[model samples]
Target: MASSRLYLSAKSAAALDAELMSSGGFSLDQLMELAGLSCAQAVYKSHPPESKRNVLIIAGPGNNGGDGLVAARHLKLFGYDPVVYYPKRPNKDIYNRLFTQLSNLKVSFTDDVNKAITETDQILDAIFGFSFQPPIRDPFVQVIRLLESTEKPVISVDIPSSWNVDSGPPKSGELGAAFMPDVLVSLTAPKPAAKFFKGRHFLGGRFVSKEIAKKWGFSLPDYPGVDQIVELPADNEKL
Candidate 1:
């Protein structure tokens, strides 16, 4: 049976990225842009019409943050105030470009993580991605606390921080204390992490995608699956 329910493992997700980069002819940067754009589309849908909803992105020093920075730029284009919380500067060359783009776009930035958490209605957890190792602590842990306490809806990019994408178990002790995401914006594919971890425990979150579904011949009916993912074919043709 082609199950109405579909689930993806982390390894499958990696393979999807490799295929998209090599066969589909998209660069990593392009993929990141699509990932962010997909995420922004979801956030826009969930937001109420009247309030000028704030999107606070918790960015760390890696590709995850790069994704968040990309999302922030797109969010701004859609007229939302996206405040980025950079706990640390990203070291990767790819992120340097992301930094430059954010700078040129004039998106706001703050080192005060606490303040950023307090001021926003929506939080994007780009602090950690799927490649993370255990023992989540310090600034990441602190950010988790803020995410939990903010009591606002959180939309995690790729995977939630302090979560093992493979094991599908949340971190123990202080790390486990954080709140679960209201939505997880898995890039280029759905993930076992997003599906099982929340499902097994009855923790609530929805797996959202725009890029991966298009590449894989799947579709998201309830979200902006069409405008973002389906439109990419025309974009690719312009290249």
Candidate 2:
């Protein structure tokens, strides 16, 4: 299906985020909570707790990782066992508070990526988002490689790790089909990279207000009653 919704470029995505915090009066934590909750809801809709109970969340050091942290907590509340693997933890107050929340919930944290991957039923790839740049570094190189080779279903948040937000996936040889997630949860709006995604796509981050949508020149799909996310058709022709 050809979508009437707007797909944001990386630059536009950043601007929208700034606008949200400045004029929109949304705090980082508030937005992250909503984004993460929507992500969890999307995951539940696609891969329910009954089947995919153990979720291994791969989180990075940025706001994307913050989203993963929030999602892990919500997933735990939803009855899914969430184990977070956040290698490079950011030393920010917001991130620290999020970690403390998860810690308070007694959520498991693991350093062994391979072991976590083996034990989990599904993976939530929150390692990167729209702000990511190319040239995968240490630690994450191994993590992304494993994600690329894993058999378990992977669900990416916003944009897939290692992919250029505006340019889609890397040129061949860098990463292959295994890196492609089985499901993608686009927050606020679908980023340009989403145009190349071929999977079950969900539009989340329903907190976007009408004024913001109109200001950004993007229309949001009407979310079903009380839903945090709305599924978009697989067709990427108009993503």
- Per-residue CA lDDT of model 1 for 36-99, tens digit only, reads 7767776776564246468898887777888888888888888888899886885778887888
Compare the candidates by TM-score and give the number of the best one.
2
Compare the candidates by lDDT and give the number of the best one: 2
Clash count list over all predictions = 0, 0
Q: Each prediction's Cα lDDT score?
A: 0.67, 0.89
Estimate TM-scores for all models: 0.78, 0.95
lDDT over C-alpha atoms for residue 238 of model 2: 47
Question: For model 2, how does the per-residue alpha-carbon lDDT over 1-239 read when each residue is reduced to its tens digit?
Answer: 23434788889999999999999999888999999998899889988999889999999999899999999999999999999999999889999999999999999999999999999999999998999986778799999999889999999999989899988888888853347999999999888888889889999958999989878877778799999999987764443
Candidate 1 residue pairs that clash: none
lDDT of model 2, residue 134: 69
| Stretches > 4 Å off in candidate 1 | 1-5, 171-174, 196-225, 229-239
